[model samples]
Target: MPKLNYETVRYGDDPQVGASNAKQIFLLEELLRAIALQGYSFTTVTPLTHQRFLLGFDGLAKNTRDIFGWNLPFKATILPPYIFKIMTEADLLFNGGDCFRSKIRISSLGEDLFLHSHFPTNDSHAVFFGPDTYRFARFVRHSLRLFQLQSGFADRSIPIRVLDVGCGSGAGGIAVIRSLPIHQLYELNLNDLNFAALEYARVCANVAGIPVNVLHGDFFNIKNSQFDLIVSNPPYLNDPAARLYRDGGSLLGLELSLRIARHALGLLAPGGRFLLYTGMAITSDDNNPLLSELLPYLANDKFQWTYDEIDPDIFGEELKQSNYQNANRIAAVGLTVMRIT
Candidate 1:
C-alpha cells in the first residue's frame, strides 16, 4: 500500500465511511460515557495484549469490563438487560452465531472515558487512543498552563480558538478544552479526513458538553480559518498497511510532520501557537534529518520554538522492516512553535 499523503486526502461523502455507522458509534459513546460515570475505566494496551486478553476469555467478553476493555465478543447474558438493549438498539450489538460484539471500544484517559475504533485498528479510518494519547494530552495541558501564566488572560473579551488538525479520536482538542476553567469561552475546531474520526470527535465533544466546529477535510482545508492554538499528534511511521492513522509518508516517516508544521505557520493568528507531537527516525549515521528539515522554518525571527525528545526510543519493533534498516532508533518528540508578528 502506498503511504498516505495528508494534503491529498479527499473530503465529501463515501459509502463505506457511512453516517449510519457514525450514529451507531454515537450511541455506543453515550452508553460508554454513562458507564464511565459509574467509576469504570480501562487503560488500553497494545494490539498484542488486546488479543491475548480476549483469547484468555475464550475470545468472548464474559463481563462488562472485558467487553469495554478488550474489545472481545460477548454473550447476551453478560450484560444488564437494559444496557444490552441499548447496544442492540444502536445496531452495533452484533451476533456472530454464538456471541455478540460491538463496533466500538471504550477506554479511559484519567477519569474521562472515550469511545474509539475497536482493537486491531487495521482499518483506514480507525480512531485510536493509547499511551501516546495520554502523553499528548499531558503536553497540551502543560502548554495551556504556560500560556495561562504568560498571557495572564488580562483581556477576557478576547476569544480563544483552537484547532486539532489531524485530530483522531478528538482527544487532544477535547482534553484541552476540558482542562480549561468552566468560565472560559472557547471554540474548538477539529479537522480530519476520516468521517468516522469526525463522528467520534462530535460524540466526544458532546459528552464533554464542549462546543466545537468540526471540519471534514485535510488540514486547513477551510482556507481562511485561523486559530489561536493548533495541535496534533500525527502518524509518524512508514506503516506497511498505509493505514490513515499510522503512515506518515516519506522522509523516513517525517513528511506529514513537516507539512503540518509549515502549513500551520501560515495559518496562525499572530500570537497563535502550535504543539506537534510525533515520532522521529534516527538513522545509523545518528542524523536527525527531520529536525534539520524543520529548522529553516523555525530559525526565522517570525517564530519562537522549542523541540524536545520525550522518548528517545520507541517502536523498536519497527526496526525489523527494510525501510528502517538504516535507522538506529525512533524517538517520540514534541515541537512547540509560536508565531510572532
Candidate 2:
C-alpha cells in the first residue's frame, strides 16, 4: 500500500516494440480527416458537458477501435447536446437511430503517436469525429502522462495496478494499460448500474485484450478493494426526471457521485489517487448547496483533493433552469483529483 509511483514501474527496455498497433494509427488519421471536413472547431465550443461532450463519442470511438480498429480525433465543443440531437435525429431520419452503429479504429505510428477513425455504421458512410471521443482520448492520455510523471515508472516495476469506475466502453482502462511502462498488470474494474453498458464494456475490454472485472451493480456496493490509481467520469447531472444514463441519483446529482467518492476513498490505498470528471450544482438561490453537502463526506484526515474545470456555462440556460429545480442559472462540471493518505 505504499505510494505506487507509476514512474518507477519498469515498462520494458525495447520501447518501440509495443508502442501502438498499426490499425490504431490508421484510425486516428481517418478521425482527423473527418473532423476537418466538419468545419467545426473545438475552440469555437467553449464549454462542453461531460456527458454529451465526451461520453457519447468516447464510447463509440473505443468500441470501434476495439471491434474494428478505428481511431478518430475529436475537439471540444460547446453545443454538444445540440450536435448529438442533430446527429441522432439525422440517423433516425434516414437509417433509424438504433440501426446505425458507431465504429472507430486506431493505428499506431510508433510507441507514442497514433491514427484513428470514427464511423457511424460502415467506413464508407462514416461521418466526422465528435468531441466526446476526443475528450475521452484526451483524458486517458493525460491521465497516463500524469501517472508516468508522478510514479516515475520509466525504470522500476514491470506491471501496474489501475482501476476505472463507470468505465464506459472501458476506454480509460484500456488507455491506462496500453500507455503504462510495464506489461499492464491492470486490475480493470468497470462498474455501472446499466446491464447493457456493462455488457458492452466487457466485450470491449475482452477485445482489447485487457483483463477486466466487470461489475453491473451500483457503485455503492463496492468496498474493501484497493488500487494504485482510480479514475472515473461518473453521471453528474441533477436531472432526476431524465433516463438512468443521464441521471443516476436523487434530487441532487451528487448522491451517486458522492457514494462513488466515498467508496473510492476506501478502495484507494495509501498514497493512491482518484481522478474523476463530474459536475457541481451551483445556483444563485440558497435552496441547496451541492458541494457543501459532499464536502463533509469528502473532508477527512485521509485525503486531499483538487477540483479542476468548474464551468458555469457547462449547461445550457434551459437545462440549468430545469435541472436546478428553478433555483439558479449557474452550475459547473468539475474535473476532480483526490489523493488518499
Q: Which candidate is the best by lDDT?
A: 1
Model 2 poorest 10 in a row by lDDT: 5-14
Query: Which runs in model 2 stand beyond 4 Å of their true positions?
Result: 1-137, 151-158, 182-184, 240-242, 285-290, 297-301, 317-332, 335-340
lDDT tens per residue, model 1, 93-163: 66789788777787777556777886778888798888889889998888778777876431356667788
- Model 2, position 306, has a per-residue lDDT of 61
lDDT of 2 by residue, 1-341 (tens): 22321211111222321233223323333343433344422211212332245445554323222322332332213223443343333331123234333233333221222222243322321221233334544665666677577643333443445667766545556666666666444456666565434544554455445666655556655555566677776656655455555454754566766677667767776767676655556555454354555677667777666664444554454354545665454344444444546
Instruction: Tell me, by TM-score, which candidate is best.
Output: 1
Rate residue 54 of model 1 by lDDT: 60
Backbone clashes, each candidate: 0, 46
| Reference-based lDDT, each prediction | 0.77, 0.48
